[model samples]
Target: MANIIAVVWDFDKTLVDGYMQDPIFEEYNVESKEFWKEVNSLPDKYMKEQGVLVNPDTVYLNQFIRYAKNGTFKGLTNKKLFEFGKKLKFYKGIPDIFEKTKKLIEEDSKYKEYDIKVEHYIVSTGMTQVIKGSSVMPYVEHVWGCELIEGEDKDGAPCISEIGYTIDNTSKTRALFEINKGVHSGDSREGVNANTKIPEEFRRVHFINMVYVADGPSDIPAFSVLNKNGGATFAIYPKGDLRALSQVEQMRVEGRINMYAEADYSEGTMAYMWICNKITEFADRIRKEERDKIAKYAGSQGPKHLVD
Candidate 1:
């Protein structure tokens, strides 16, 4: 048992509401819904016009999937993309969740025995800088999300040259590989750390503790991955978001999530309370098992061996 070494989070709709709602898209005279509809409608012709050289099915399918799932766009220069990122906002009580989760990680006795260290990470397909500039940045360990190609303008602020669209389950796994354990993309397996191997870890421990909270279909892949890996995932449906609720139900039906609950951040809110309870239960189980192990080991030792 170990104090939670890391806690990963999904940005955009999870920690914040309406980031992908895209007011700027609306401001730019493109309704996101209309844009998605148009993109889906023009698959073959659009791919041909863009001169996309990749697998046509992959490109076209991902065009719609990315837009619907993660709100990605094509042909946008990184500068304009980052500019759009700068304007996003968060949901109510988000700041408090960080402050409180941090405090609990530090002060809770059950977690303390695990030498639990808490690291907040955002796995998002949204803009990195958008998350970086938010109030939550100071609390998180690292952000793995869409990055802009780094180029400076006349004012010396980094401009977005291209959106990497670098957050999702697969990318999240890659981030865990590269950042946490220095595994590079396409690197030989020989170079990787054994501890970071997810499959091996799952096999060794009947219960590997993790908690993931996410908002919508975009999070399904991530939730599914975490849940399948012997971790718990909570699907959150924010108030006023019927779409999120619908997605939650679908995820439940697919057996893709561990739990589904409303997205609320008040100390007494269902989401907050449920997460706290789950963390507490995991911490308690690990702590009790660790104590029993220690006691058993102590009892197995020869008494006063030095006296002999």
Candidate 2:
């Protein structure tokens, strides 16, 4: 039995109150609203002008690179992105919830016996460096997100010249399988893509042992993946934001998520309660499975004689 329980997260509005890049826009004195407007138009603009198709989820990175190259976001490097992470404002009960939920598994003696524990992973479309620098980085087991490669500008100043990696909404499911198979984690394991024949029960983290949390429409692909695979799913909406609330409610109505809550993860909040309960539930099931397996596979006591 895979004794590890995984909690996967999507980082943008799911955790923070706003986009992580807002700090960058602030630092550059650019109108973030207008920048996003252009970003939203890039896919169709490219198709009409350059006969090209682009990923709507990540084409914004290209715009970022363009601005960096043009001196608008002068000397923008991964290091700067890391520094920007400190400026992020997370939702209520953030890293606190992360720590508290993880401790639930530790509270049970059976969980300790089976080495069952919870691990937190962030799979995002945002910059990885920023997340690595966030307050919650210490609690996070791993992060999968967009990346940038640093190179010199014409003046030899450091800048982000190229995109290194990207995890779009759809590709986010690949990160799910990676966590399922223990890729890029402490365990030395193959990519989920490398071995197509691995049985579900044999994966490093089974789907039943996972819980995924995120906020909006961009999370549909990931939510679908977990929902169909027996994993738990949750959605978050900002408080008093009826549009955000309605979005998640519709998703719940459509059976895309097991639950939805406001974006507060602090103690006594809905987000905290639901996530912690799910972790406890998974741990309970895993404890049962491990104990049952030991009895079933321990080789039948060599034909026991009735002594009683």
Candidate 3:
């Protein structure tokens, strides 16, 4: 059986104080509010003018390209996106929590015996280049996000020209399965589609071994996927931001998220405590499963009096 526990995360408000791409807007002097206003309107705008119903989640990538081509976001390139990532203000405990969670499975003798390990992944609708450049990237095992294709602009400067791939809210489920099946690790060549034939015992990481953390309603699709499949979900709302809190609270009431916490992920914060507890629980459960399996086949479970 695979001894892996995956903690998948959503970007944006979940990790940083605000959007990861906010630096892009600030750097280019583009009004972030106005750009988002346009992004929010594009789907309906296209449907009305051309009868094409676009994906609201990732249509912003096209707008990013449009701005680059028009010189509004002049010289916006993958390199620039990476630079912007460094400016992001990540919430408290971020990358530290990543390493801490992984270490949890190693501290206990029982946990260590089973070889259970935690792997961190980011599945976001934000820019991949930006996420890769963030302070937290060093702790992350893999990232899934909207990627940009770079090409030469008129001045022969490399610029972001096209949307290479998009991991919208709905598609985040696929990334989860990719983790579940170990696709990103290159252990499962059959891909996520081969899941039905792959038994739970053999799959890289079972759904029960996953914990998904995100921000709001846009994560409903991902939340539902994990909830329905026996995984856990946690929501993070900005501290003192009632609107953000309300959004997550409503999701909890709707059964989308298993729990909600303030964005601070510091060592003693709710987010940190809850996540660590979940990891401990998952490790213990895996230990039990492994022990039970061995006992079943060996027909020897040691002495009941000696069992703790």
Best by lDDT: 2
Per-residue lDDT of model 1, residues 183-246, tens digit only:
3212224456525554543222222466777776666666666676677777777787788788
TM-score quality measure for candidate 3: 0.93
User: In candidate 3, what are the lDDT values of residues 1-308, reduced to their tens digit?
Assistant: 76888999999999989998788888888899999998999999999999998999999999998888777888999988988888998998978999888777877777888788888999999999999999988778899999999986666677899888888998898898878777776365653562456666667889988999999999898888889999999999998999989888888888989999999999999999999999988888889999999889899656667666
The lDDT values for all models are: 0.60, 0.89, 0.88
Put down candidate 2 lDDT per residue, 1-308, tens digits, no spaces: 69898999999999999999999999999999999999999999999999998999999999998888878889999999999999999998888888887788877776899889889999999999999989999889889999999886767788999999999999999888888877777873654452455777778889888999999888999899888889999999999999999989999999989899988998998889899989999998888887788889785677767897
lDDT value, candidate 1, whole model: 0.60
* Per-candidate count of clashing residue pairs (backbone under 3 Å): 5, 1, 0
How far residue 22's Cα lies from its native spot in candidate 2, in Å, is 0.8
In model 3, residue pairs whose N, Cα or C atoms come closer than 3 Å (at least 3 residues apart or on different chains), thus clashing, are none
What is the Cα root-mean-square deviation between model 3 and the actual structure?
4.5
Best-to-worst order by lDDT is: 2, 3, 1
For model 3, the superposed segments whose C-alpha errors exceed 4 Å read 186-197, 300-308
lDDT of 3 at 34: 92
Candidate no. 2 TM-score: 0.94
